[model samples]
Target: MLAKRIIPCLDIKNNEVVKGINFEDLKSAGDPVALAKKYDDELADELMFLDITASSEKRKTILKLVEKISENIFIPFSVGGGVSEIEDIHNLLNSGADKVSINTAAVINPEIIDEAAKKFGSSTIVIAIDAKKVGDEYLVFTYGGKKNSGINAIQWAKEVYNRGAGEILLTSMDKDGTKSGYEINLTSMVVRSVKIPVIASGGARDAKDIEEVFVKADAGAALAASIFHYENSGIISIKKYLKSKGINVRL
Candidate 1:
């Protein structure tokens, strides 16, 4: 079996790393470059840097910030937020991002998924889905989780995969930053809907929460922020814990 990945996410805003509960009431964490270096040194499987406000602010992702953070980390790094057209993806990749994640833009012009995958290979294209549970179904949100697109998360995941996206970065807005645990039912729905790998995000408090998602939901990866950012638990310890639980992970 392929080793499940443990990823650290850095939510960037105005060139600073930040975290929040339910995607509101943001609090400063630290310098993005510093955080990136720390996570890389800690043996994290991957690093994801998302410009949390770029899409909402109606601007492009900060290339200089991406470049600076990319230089500090040796592991695979994925960059997202405010990425729209093929040119944006090209610029980000050239700026040193191993993968470019499209959320708002992909919802607006999903054709970009096929276009980017064809140009940069599917492995380089990731569709970041920010979803919120509305009644009985999880609906897709865009523009940094400000607007509901009325798109069903499961259907969108399948569409993204069919359109050539290599992976899905699924985040539950309701569960984000709560540190309660991942939304397993929501995550499992998306994972089951797609043939590609699904990286489960939001509300990770400890290793057991991650283990649960991996075991119950069959998530390809578990992405967390606050726990890692605050040093509540490091990647090494988390990996050790997962291995002890008989989860397949790279040591």
Candidate 2:
């Protein structure tokens, strides 16, 4: 079995790392480059840098910022936000991102997924889906979780995989920053609906929460921010805890 990965997510706004509950009321956490290096040193399985406002603000991801963080971290790094075109993906990859995640653009023109995968290889493309549960249906949101795409989340997951996306970064907006746990029901549904790897994001509080997602939902990875950003836990400690629980992880 492949070892489950633990990724530290850094949401960037104005070049600073920020955190918020349910994607609102954002507050600065720290410097992005510094945090990236810290996570790398702590042996985090991977690092995700998201320019939280780039898409909503109508600008490209800060390549300079991506370049700086990439310089500090040796681990695989994934970047997202304001990525709308092949050129954006090319620029981000050249700037040191191991993978480029597209959300709003993918919904606007899913053909880009097929085109990008063909041009850059499936491994280089990641489709980020921000979903919110409305009644019994999970709807996809875009533009940094500001707009509802009205697309069914589960179906979209399968569509992206069929279009040749390498992976899916699934974020539950309702669970985001709550730190209660990942939305397991929602995650499990997406996981079972697609064959490609799915990185579960939002509402991760501790190692047990991660373990639950990996065990119950069968998530490929669990991404968190609060625990790591606030010193509530460290990557090494979390990995050790998961290993103790008999979960396969890279320590």
Per-residue accuracy of model 1 over 118-198 as CA lDDT, tens digit each: 999999999999999999999999988999999999999999999999999999999987889999999999988889999
Give per-residue CA lDDT, model 2, range 75-180, as digits (tens). 8999987788999899889888899999999999999999999999999999999999998999999888999889999999999999999999999999997878
Clashing pairs in 2: none
Q: Which portions of model 1 miss their true places by more than 4 Å? A: 20-29, 53-61
Candidate 1: count the clashes: 0
Query: What overall lDDT, based on C-alpha atoms, would model 1 receive against the true structure?
Result: 0.86
Top candidate (TM-score):
2
| Per-candidate TM-score against the hidden true structure | 0.90, 0.91
So what's the TM-score on candidate 1?
Answer: 0.90
Clash count list over all predictions:
0, 0
Cα error, residue 174 of model 2, in Å, equals 1.7
lDDT of 2: 0.86
